[model samples]
Target: MPTKSNNTGGRGGARAGAGRKKSAVKEKSENGNPGGRPLEVLDIPEMEGVEMPKPHDFLSAEQRDGSELQAADIYRETWEWLKRIGCSQKVSSQLLERYAMASARWIQCEEMTSKLGFLSKHPTTQKPIPSPFINIGINYMNQAVRLWNEIFQIVKENCNTEYSDEAPQNDVMERLLRARKGN
Candidate 1:
């Protein structure tokens, strides 16, 4: 008697309806959209009864003539300059705040420099001693100057202004002073 033949075609062979169905909806495509359609844009909701604070809000009317007010003015001017130079709002806002802080620090340094002279007399030795406060004020002023320079460079580059590390030959204020003196 012949033995019954028993052989499977192959391991994990394809069968009817074994893979994904052709009619099924694609959840996502290679371009990262579902059903081959882009996502919808939504409008931002309007805020009501919320007022934005002014830049100079930190200073009172009486204190508006101080360094804090000057800082706020610098911040506003820097913001406008950055915007005119086509900087993004986020970057402009950040840089404006930084510039304002630097200006304020510079003012503080000026005050410190005025109060603390370059040299101080020794408490009892009757000799001169270098004033540590002056050194600190100088450091702060240097940092502030550096920050201002960097910010100005960025603005110049963005606005495609003539790049020059040297000072201008005829200063406007100097020319005005000469005219006034001659007349």
Candidate 2:
């Protein structure tokens, strides 16, 4: 039998002071960087006479039920938000369109799930199963979130000043609910 040694070299695993460095802005605010160089300032110029673009006609149709029309409205709302935040210049039309489509699909899935209920009968097996809309809704929601994060990252990288929401009264869910109810 070989004797077991207790000594182990510090080759792997996390060490002290490892991983990502804290934000320079946060560090400067907390402890004050006395000798460090000053942080760079970004000056984003305002565009004069900038007009909001109209979404493509495919986004809405009278024949196609509620979701199509709602998607166009959602796209307009999102555009208004970007413009209000002074970050509209950073977002592209394609990216915003993708986000709106994902969100509208998610809402459509949820509405279907509500009507269909959780359980369903398999066509071939004749056995009860979970509704397909549940999984579809989750996927659409995740895609929307991922797109939103990408948009947010663009805004975060470009904006120099701290972004704050002035109107907390206008909640997203409430607006959606009101739209759904036709209130």
Candidate 3:
């Protein structure tokens, strides 16, 4: 008697129909979702005829002392923000004073730099000449910039807001709370 042979090779047995079948009809939901839950539409009520309060007027009267003029708008806005952040009157005044001083120094540095550029020229060659005052002005400008940055940082820290272009989750208060929670 001849025995029956079993040859499971050449695209036979497990290899045949092992992949997914291509469906002729595309499956879809009644809400047009393709294999997910239906979209939700919320019915929000409209708030018509609600009068909003105007922002506080922070610009104060300008003061002029002979040749020097005070920037009332800058001082006013700074004072308003500092007050909103719960800063004391004395601290706010001190910060504003420092800011004004730095701003004045910055203006003076700009003037000095411009004057130096005009004065720094050779008599015959007409070439630009170097002077120590340029460097001094640059140093003063740097100091003023540093003070301005310090003031901004102080305000940002006290106000619990992020001034940089980072992600919202990286806020100072969020980080502090996360650290306190041992997250």
Candidate 3 C-alpha lDDT tens digits along 1-183: 855465643444566435644221122223365546543332333344433222223322232423342223335445555444433232345556555444444444445455445357767898777755567656755764565555654444333323344321123224334433545
* Candidate 2 to native Cα RMSD, angstroms: 7.1
lDDT (10s digit) by residue, model 1, range 85-169: 4332323455545556555544544454455656778899979998766666567556656666556544443333333433211
Query: What lDDT score is found at residue 30 in candidate 1?
Result: 30
User: Candidate 2's residue-wise lDDT over 63-153, tens digit each?
Assistant: 3554444567777888777788777766888888888777777777776676678888899998999998899989988988878777766
- Residue 183 of model 1 has an lDDT of 27
Q: Give the TM-score (vs. native) of candidate 3.
A: 0.37
RMSD of each: 21.6, 7.1, 24.8
Give me the displacement of residue 66 in model 1, in angstroms. Answer: 9.0
* lDDT comparing candidate 2 with the true structure: 0.68
Using lDDT as the measure, name the better of candidate 1 and candidate 3: 1
Global Cα lDDT for candidate 3: 0.43
Question: What are the TM-scores, per candidate, against the unseen true structure?
Answer: 0.41, 0.68, 0.37
**Residue ranges of candidate 3 with Cα displaced over 4 Å:** 1-66, 69-77, 81-91, 115-133, 161-183
How much does candidate 2 score in TM-score? 0.68
Score each candidate by Cα lDDT.
0.47, 0.68, 0.43
